[model samples]
Target: MKKLTLPATVPVKELAERLSVSGPELIKYLMGNGVMASLNQSVDFDTAALAADHFGFEAESEEAVAEAAPASTRRRHPLLDQSRADPKSLVARPPVVTVLGHVDHGKTSLLDAIRETAVASGEAGGITQKIGAYQVEKSGRKITFIDTPGHEAFTAMRARGADVTDIAVLVVAADDGVMPQTEEAIQHVRSAEVPIIVALNKIDKDGANPDRILQQLADRGLVSSDYGGDVTVVRTSAKTGEGVTDLLDMILLTADAEVEPKADPKVGAVGTVIESHRDPGRGPVATVLVQNGTLRVGDYIVAGQVYGRIRALLDERGERMQQAAPSTPAVVTGLSGVAEAGDVFQVMANERSARSLAEERGFAAKQQQAQPVRRITLADLASQVAEGSVKSLNVIVKAEANGSLEALRGQIEKIEDPNVKVVIVASGVGPVGEADVNLAAVTDSIVIGFNVRPDDRAKAAADTQGVDVRYYDVIYQIADDIAKAIKGLYEPTFVDVFQGRAEVRQVFTVDGRPAIAGSHVIDGRIPRNSICTVLRDGKQIARSRVAVLKRFKDDVREVARGYDCGITLEDFGDFAVGDVLEAYTVEQQNL
Candidate 1:
């Protein structure tokens, strides 16, 4: 038998020809596996493997095809090629700092205060929203600030292996003390191995206690230098601009005392995508922060799968610039599409080289999508727990309204399992869709929808990608489900709640045994095999299990309220005309 050559995905007809089988036969084989593919329809590796086994042929993924080719054919991204740089040309660059904290903790306000101070000092670039980034001048030096929404965006950018930031400024509200998101931000900063400069904000508010905030920081492993630790804590109020200058001074001092932010500005520009969006006038715009070299006008850059020339370079002031140096944030126009946030951007030799690299990486990404995915299930949580792989249960929540989503998020995050942390990857209002499933798959998170339903496409993708999609009408139910999952062994118990009462009109004998009681359902429907209690004038006579419930001569599952039906109970013989039959059902609720 000849070995079948498969490119990540292969058409049914093409595989059939390689296997010497008829196309219809291959399609029938695929149909047995639940993949209804036509002759020309492409099948992923799983489908291809099954077809190849049935037809006595060998199939390999596209990665094997690349391995069979010459080593020179495989292209490495230029940004990863460290040998291309010259150590002699390296120079000190501004430290790229990310301000992370809980929402409304003065993260944006501190950035604004720094920008205003820099602008007052005759800095060329004013604050620009295009890149969500800016640079502030301090002591004849520059410190770049990436104004992300929160710590999640900061971690998401780092998750893509784009280590762009040199330091993290952790902002904490003095009045609020240490919040849940504050701890999360601290973890992200520590995980990234970036030094943190604590910015204690909101000191102007009533009941503000900087000392209390410092004590809380001690509990989280962040001791202040005043307390005989290396961490620097600067108390600042962004609203009044008090101690804001001191905060900037501390950032510069920390950068010098700790790690020196240096880059080779003599080489081609290499950086990361801070933010990206589509503009009405421009085709695709990206807010890129150049980490190394100098990005100039007309430079061809490839960011992840998107490649384009620098049609225009706009500084943080929204004014056109000729070039941007290391740690400089610039809005570049003319990308083929909006590159993903956190995608690494590099300047190639020419447009053709950039295009070729993008195409190569794009193809490789598609091939990775074709590989088999091991779907994580509730049962697998045990194995993950044993392997210590499940330290946290990451969740993406979708809801019908912002208020409900926030409520659900707040309650779910409170599900405390010291062994397993619960992290909310993303949350929004609306029906759960494919985008949510994609994010969950990428982050190894589960999609949780509260008072919302997943569309058919999202459901299918979740199943295919092995992402768990759970729907709940009540907020507490979702919380309980996740709590049980993290605990790994907590089984729930249920109690039977009475549904309704019915009166027996008459009784009939079947095969010489007390069989059916002809009754009228007084309230609520009576379900089949539900527990019933025989009562005589509000006094309990006996309790029996419902054997069968029938409406008329037909065997029906349920008898609705205000309807006549026959009910049969096991191990019960006595029947009375005035007897009442009460029905109840048991439902399991997680504790």
Candidate 2:
């Protein structure tokens, strides 16, 4: 049979042409396999493989074919060829190591023991504030270590395309065994395709159980070399400073076996920005891992949108360094702006060229930012649910009263899915505020309001941050909506659009009924029976629809701006002079 090579994804027409089959015939074959696609629609490698097999051909991914291809040239170090580096300049560089594990797993303590920095004592609650790269000498060789908080920070950097880690030291507490965060760290390093050396920490404690920990590791597919596996397990106690040297030796051994052994130090310095922040004393500063060449003081450098000549180079200890060599981490000052984590930095020829390059990159970044950012919408969560990757449906609930708040929290927490969990990251009683929206935005959660509404600042923040804000007057509707959304069976079309705001000038009641607000439409027109929130003293007291809208003696559909009108709201009768009435229409969203 003829063999065919294909990319990771190919359109139906393109795949058909490559497989020597007609487009309709390929479509027919795809339909027979229960896949519905047009000729121009793209299909993944597996789908393409099925189609190719039906056409009397064997399909292999382009990557698989390349791996089996004959060598045409000498294999050069992957990092060196980027700079057109001279082979003579290539020499062994220190391996960059990242310490990752669960919180309270002694990762920071182990680093403090190795580097002797006492950083864990100064940190609030012993959690590292941020990730920074530093180097420590083991015997005659040096190894760079990055003190990361957890797997979240680890994967966040890789998502930006920086592949800096050479080896991963997974610190698992002997007593804690395999924690959720430990599993997450393992998953991240495996995805990054780096070598791992297990550091079984906290061995000196009475509760430490190394055997159970090792068994847990074996269960997670990280069997020890004693059991015919490649993983190296080193026992260490950060408190007593035991087996620290052996772990370092194992790191060097793994680096020799895994990382590219040589780098060209004679070339211009190119590195990744580990993390950057504003220093009150030193302006914009960044901890950069020098990957390929020497980074020197006064060198012009450009990282993403920022460019500046380095005024000073400081080590992780705050000590001054004249230059940073390959595999060294330097805290650099004098950047034009704060570079983001994982931004690749390179030394430029001069200030002029660096500024030009920075400006060009800044423009391109802005253009890319125009694309929609990934948000944790119900649709997005539903897809993750299908893949069994979604761990939690985080929610921020805000209701009208404390009783209602408790009720909503109980109902939302009771929702259970075998694949995904429902977690209330934050909940409170009141109108949704800006802080609530911000928390929801960072946590990728939905902000649900029951019998309450969000303020103007929160509304704007939700829109800008792409946060999903839902308002429901009914209590059980919240849980019902979430359940349907997770199963991909529910997508409500009703979306809130701001109508207008009105200020109360008079308060009265007709026929001893609910209080009515005689007000002036200050901004836009207030539609009849639209969602209206009554606010007093800049705080929302009630969220409901306008029960009645009128102008003088004539009942009107809406009251326009610069006009006075009479308005009555549902579920709210208490009216105070100078209270603001905000209106919004519930319209069907296009998508």
Q: Give all candidates' CA lDDT scores.
A: 0.78, 0.78
Over 1-591, each residue of candidate 1 has an lDDT whose tens digit, in order, gives: 224456678777556544444455677778888898876479887778778877665566657755765533112223432322355767888988889998878888878777777652376344445468877787789888888887767765665657677789999999988886787677557656679999999899998999999999997789999899889999999999998899888888888889787777776788889889898988798998898779999998888889989999987778899999998989999889889998988886677667766775676578768886566655466457656778877888888997998899899878897788888866777898765676665567777888899889888877677787777888987887777778775354568788888999998887997767899999987888898999998998888888988878888888888999999898786878979999988754322
lDDT of 2 by residue, 51-164 (tens): 878776667787775687763322222222332334576899988889988889999889878866323223323433333776677667888887766665665566455667
Report RMSD (Å) for each prediction in the order shown.
13.8, 14.5
Alpha carbon lDDT at 286, candidate 1: 90
Clashing pairs in 1: none
Off by over 4 Å in 1: 1-86, 120-130, 374-591
TM-score of model 2 vs. true structure: 0.54
